[model samples]
Target: MPLTAAVLLRSAALSDQEFLDALYLSTRDDLQALAADPALRPMIAPMIAMQQKAQGLSYQASYPGAEYLVIEHAGAPVGRAVVHADADGLRLVDLSVLPQARGQGCAGSTLVQLQQRAAEGGCELHLTVRLANTGARRLYERLGFDVVSDDGLDARMRWRP
Candidate 1:
């Protein structure tokens, strides 16, 4: 959101699980709405944990060598990014910033850094964003990523140096 947010990435550690879990929940507005219902509130915690685990497992299965990094601002963890670099290119398996840290340029700055890495290595940067996530798709387009293909649910985008 701002020019001086100082967002950076560091390897995520096992000890960061609590923070990571909270961050994951923060990104799920659907879950938040559901949890607001009295009947659903009781199911929120377990659901979050289950979904987080499933997501981790899916990413690991799909991107075997992905780097799991914590997105930091002024040395504080504000988000997480999972990236996989291969001979084809660098794929951003996942990226999410906490609600409090959104609109402060954390995610954008992180993507720029990833673009730099991709440029240095002469490879394309790749990612898939949910079709429902128009905000993120717009941001990626602003950073010069082009939509290469799309299914009904998600769109595959690419940025080449």
Candidate 2:
């Protein structure tokens, strides 16, 4: 399902740190599998923080002008999306929805809109997803994105109009 007309994207603000942090944690619940190792359990928070920070820095370095947008559903924040329009066309830097928002159609609609934007620009939209995230890969595939490459950890996908 794609996003409905009720869902909107707004630029993320400095004051949204707490919201962002919670969103970040929701996506990383699998890391709890490592909690079996008492030593690693205590490091989860710091590790996730470091990982998220590194991802942020990498996105900035790669797409300095990328729009970090928060996905809002009926005026409530539901997720985050990063998109960059450059000489290479459009890059979907990141997109994540809260578990509560899953299957709500908002994300699908947002992605469809991005694909339309890429088509209007006469180029393809590119993104990479974790191989473990099959649900996301399926969504991308349903949206006409094809896997360009896959190396255990990540699979690069592209969608062209």
Candidate 3:
């Protein structure tokens, strides 16, 4: 987890549109599995681009207080973490990393650090994950988060320090 020390969380900005757009694309991996045709894979990026813009606007309108952060490694943006922390706990709205950066231990290390921060404040960390994303669910479970609630499509997990 030594690499965790090198990760920087910075405030996101309008200037990061292009990088964020690309990062947003990286987060849509579930689409690949849902795609029925291999040839249609090429269309994924454009569709996601449009959806990302719409979602960005929607998120702004819905969760204005959520802290939008860009995960930077060695001065370059590599991922994004959208979080909201209050008196109750820290809620992770989203965590995404570029495909090229996967399996590098960056996201895990940073998340552990965030869990520590939440613990220091005597707050629990919470997040709702899509049920279809089993890979991410396993990761969160490994980090000590447990399922607290579930709908058919999503599960809400909580991590207490």
lDDT of 3 by residue, 49-144 (tens): 778878878877766798999998878889999888776789888899888777777688668878998999899998889999897898899999
Q: Pick the candidate with the highest TM-score.
A: 1
Candidate 2 lDDT over residue span 21-119, tens digit each: 889888876775765688888898788889989989998998998999999897888999999988878999989899999998878878987888888
Ranking by lDDT: 1, 2, 3
lDDT string, candidate 1, 1-161, tens digits:
46565788999999999999999888888999998899999999999999998998998888997999999998899999999998889999999999888888899999999999999999999999999998899999999999999999999999999
Output the worst ten-in-a-row residue range by lDDT, candidate 2. 1-10
- lDDT of each prediction vs. the true structure? 0.93, 0.88, 0.83
RMSD of every prediction: 1.4, 2.8, 3.4
User: Following a full C-alpha superposition, what root-mean-square deviation does model 2 have from the true structure?
Assistant: 2.8
Q: What is the lDDT of candidate 2?
A: 0.88
My TM-score estimates for the predictions, one after another, are 0.93, 0.83, 0.81
Q: Which runs in model 3 stand beyond 4 Å of their true positions?
A: 1-5, 29-49
Q: What pairs collide in candidate 2?
A: 2-105, 2-108, 2-109, 3-106, 3-109
- Candidate 3: global Cα-lDDT? 0.83
Model 2 / residue 158 / CA error / Å: 0.9
Q: Once model 3 is optimally superposed onto the true structure by TM-score, how far is the C-alpha of residue 82 displaced, in angstroms?
A: 0.5
Query: 2 or 3: which has the higher lDDT?
Result: 2
